[model samples]
Target: MIESAFPIVEVPDMEAALRFYRDALGATVVYRFPPDGEPLFATLQAGSAQLGLGLAEGATAGEGAGMLLWFYVDDVDATTRALSDAGYLVLEEPSDSEWGERVALVSDPFGTRVRLGQPIAPQPDEE
Candidate 1:
């Protein structure tokens, strides 16, 4: 049985990756192994999700396909602002989607696309 799931991102440099996650995404360092050094594996907490960062031998950002991860927030505007202020690049500004969600797309320093979304206001009772 799968108890939980988390995304692991391969980065060129673990230290820089950790800094980006910590500073840009406001992720907190939960637990880190091999605590004695840099270029090691570390885990971070963003809301209820956990993201792992590891040193990729020779991998580059955006080397893979498909959506890496998505984070759901209560307020898209606030989240976007926070990420922007923290030095992340905002690929797409927050906008209400036709599917009924306020979403903003952001790219992390490591080139991972983070889809931040908040449920739209419930439509008033239909007549």
Candidate 2:
């Protein structure tokens, strides 16, 4: 049986990741490896979702594992804009998708691609 599952990403700077995630997404620091000083690994929780950040040794920003992170936000456009204003690169603008979501693409502080979306409410049928 599986107890829990979450994505743990390697980051060039733990503090940078912490600031971005915490400030932008309102994530809270659930735990840290050392609990003091500079931690090598930290886990954050935002809503029901959890993300882990591991300090990458001898690695520069944007050098970690290449993977696209997806998140379901309350407002895709607003969230994307905040991230972009915070210096994250905007890859795509928010638009409605055929899959019933308003989706947008942006890069995190470490240059990792992040996809944010919110389900679009169904429209009423007109006679």
Most TM-score-accurate candidate = 2
Query: TM-score of model 2 relative to the true fold?
Result: 0.84
Each model's lDDT comes to 0.79, 0.82
Poorest 10 consecutive residues by lDDT, candidate 2: 57-66
lDDT (10s digit) by residue, model 1, range 1-127:
9987777888777777876778766789887778776646788998877888877777566526565568788899998998899788888999988777899988877777888888887732321
The candidate maximizing lDDT is: 2
Instruction: Please estimate how well model 2 matches the true structure, expressed as its whole-model Cα lDDT.
Output: 0.82
Q: After superposition, how far is residue 113 of candidate 1 from its true place, in Å?
A: 1.0
Task: Count residue pairs with overlapping backbones in model 1.
Answer: 0
**Residue 52 in candidate 2 has what lDDT?**
90
Off by over 4 Å in 1: 1-4, 123-127
Pull out the clashing pairs in model 1: none
